[model samples]
Target: MKKIKNNFICKIIEKDILKNKHIKIRTRFPPEPNGHLHIGHAKSIFINFNIAKIYNGKCNLRFDDTNPYKENIKYINIIKKDIIWLGFKWNKKIKYSSNYFNTFYKYAMLLIKKGLAYVDSLNKFEIKKYRGNLKKKGTNSPFRNRSILENINLFKKMKIGKFQEGDVCLRAKINMSSKIILMRDPVLYRIIKKKSHHQTKKKWCIYPTYDFSHCISDYIEKITHSICTIEFQENKKLYNWILKNINIKKKPKQYEFSRLNIENSLLSKRKIKILIKKKIIKNWSDPRLLTISGLRKRGYTPSSIRKFCYNIGITKKENLIQMSYLEHFIRNDLDKKVNRAMAILNPIKIIIYNLPKNYKKIISIPNHPKIKKFGKQNIILRREIYIEKNDFEEKNKKNKKKLFINGKVKLRYSYIIKAKKIKKDRLNKIKTIYCKYYNKKQSKKIKNNIIIHWISKKESIKANFEMYENLFTTKHPEKKKNMLQYINKNSIIIKHGLVQKDIFSKILKKYIQFERIGYFFLKKNKIKNITFTCITKLKK
Candidate 1:
């Protein structure tokens, strides 16, 4: 639980502070509220919030909600919930880029008056063509040379919805001949005839682009360091250019770091949305997904995720972490905490023929090993019981040590039993295993070869158990031409199972380890006098 301080980014921030450069570091996590935050966002949040906390500075949760067509209030609320779930709190009230629309508009006008930016009449396709390639210089738009007065008037008209979508755009008047293509007059604003904004609503039709609004918003809020993904490294030049051109009192520095990537999942919101739209996935919060809500549904704890992030740390080099590493973290976190119970999956009836038919006894089982404070639960022992079919074998020739007919093994924490006979169905499939239990004191005198888990059939609860595996068959499912082609067909296996009667008495939502099996959570659906469902841990 000690604070992590070994990351290179933290060292850089410390170096800056010691040099008396950017005395009060202010950071911001600016997420576009178009979709649910993913694991990649978790890294950004951790770095930003922790840096601020380290320096005793401030971090702001700013929503870059300029795109009215894709942004929504639902996404905003979900983002807030996700940040809080990851254990981060902003220094002050939540802020949105849309709140500075009027300010951004005035700045755009300032650029026009100074002949630094102009309204371009080129359509979207023509603008891309004019922008040229990386090795070439772009041609100036025909409207780029328009008088400052005309360009300002056209920008005003676009704001009032006089132009159709993509008809006119505001572009920064940077050099087209510059080596960096992003420095070549990037589009600052575009016209969109969307319905309305979630916060602003119908006030304007023209919206500022991310490249234009991002840096200026940081300066407006007096941010000291703007941390973003490495993909925006090229955009950093334009970010600096806009701040230098504008008359901002304090300029913020932009830093880039590599975004996090998981081996077997798609992190793009667009791809996930397509899957959900095509019904390939159940929903956004499907347990197979890597979203926060999805992880929550899959029985992952917030603390475990935070620990996973901490272990991975922050870095500039991109990495593809194996999914097993995450599972290892989860197992390590839950092993000491979760209480233990016994549940038998794929059960076959075991008949104790030597025991009295009417005999019954209660045996005590500890809830947790090496933890005396957790107490114990009472398990009933009867004539009929259920054990996993995989725990037994039909023949002993191939495997002489196997648990077969006439073989001896200890029933976990109970007496030793010798298999008397195996009864097969008409198709020669083993249906019943008949055994004879040795007397209690006599069984304890001798050690059994194998220890197996079993539940009393008479007092057992019949339930349906679900075992989940990785949703993808390959390491990079999204990189393939068809994700479904790599889908793990055996991701989920359902079995008619049985568990000790003590487990059936509790209806809590918390997860519990099933002794030799994996962890399980109670399913929402309950059958009337017939069955119950529990979701098992994800297979490694």
Candidate 2:
């Protein structure tokens, strides 16, 4: 059995267990399926799922699909796929708030019959005016004093689509003078006519608000711990009040922890939608975005993400984590998992003068420098090859380590090569480097020679290398007045490159480290050429 770390929430659960508060524990990941889940939701998923795993409890994957106007069946499927990709399985068949629409209606009726809830006919603006701000006490609604029978009848009529949208709503009859405004008769159910719910469809015209449905769903599911981010701290009062008023015993408890906020990353679904709408990002799975789909597409492994969440842990203190902290984990993970391949991003041709024309030899290179179990890959070495343009120089400087004129450098896994001459194009750019190759025994005297990765021209394939950086230039773009100004123009830099044919080996993983370059994954796009996205730069 795995032991859970002693966080505040975990401690509370432990105390409950020791005191025999319950025989079994239940937790849930209740995401509203209006949009794809982001890294912030990854934290919540980690908490709920792992807590259930460590406690031998069951965690339900429940979609809080109360707002059918925004929610979609596609988004629900995407959410389920992401959770499964992150290596979590729901305790039972997937759950949805719509699954308990009848139960929720019954509970709402119970509230109205107990004189704890009332149907108000005030317009949205009027309702807002009556519900005052934090410093002011809200005034009672004009329809607040309606008789229980009348309120129930009005609610029934509202449910049956007799009232137009926003004309009437069901509200809890909590204190209007209470400092907590959410308790000031929060709207429970409202009229949203004609819009067909993904699940219920036109079977009903009324929909329950999140505040109303979330707690009830938790109670109906028998969730022992209604865990959520700190933004819901005040809502805990309402969550308990609804259960209490319904006269339900053994009510679930709501615990709040700080949400994950990374520097220069946007986790808000509304903001992400705006970016997509403006064509700034391709979609929810844009490699540059921090969404779970985006991260997976960018070659971030499930283990690495889970490890990152565990390292960050659950805390009530809100702090913005550095993006590099996440990069560090992926680097550590891929360093061991990823195989090595040679790719020339900026190619400069190299010709061995001493070798015969059509000279070719198949050589085996180890896939990983430290892991022999990864085995080796077969690559071709020929007379004509390509090396990184920056790997060679015409003019030799003091202590220059690259293949400069009359300077020597070792071609990795092959031979020591010394540049003899270079061919220049009309633009004065080095077109080709003419060099001589020496056997390892003959080059034994060469001291402090740098080794460079190279690929045979005939055996290499054309590829595009996509380099990615932070999407936002500033650390706290959310605080800025015009966040669009902070968008990093160079977030994605594409370059045409050449990759060794061995890169297509069957044993290769989704992501591989380009020798002398950074890590990369085969890009999944419709482009004809083989494309790879740079996961990250080599550790400095």
For every model shown, what is its TM-score relative to the native structure? Answer: 0.92, 0.93
Candidate number with greatest lDDT = 2
Backbone clashes for every candidate come to 0, 0
Write model 1 residue lDDT over 213-318, tens digit each, in one string. Answer: 9998999888888989898999999998888888876788888888777887878898898889977678878777788877777777778888888888766787
Output the number of the TM-score-best candidate: 2
lDDT of each: 0.82, 0.88
How much does candidate 1 score in TM-score? 0.92
Question: Which residue pairs overlap in candidate 1's backbone?
Answer: none
What range of 10 consecutive residues in model 1 has the weakest lDDT sum?
527-536
Compared with the true structure, what per-residue lDDT tens digits does model 2 show for residues 463-498? Answer: 899999999999988777788899999999998988
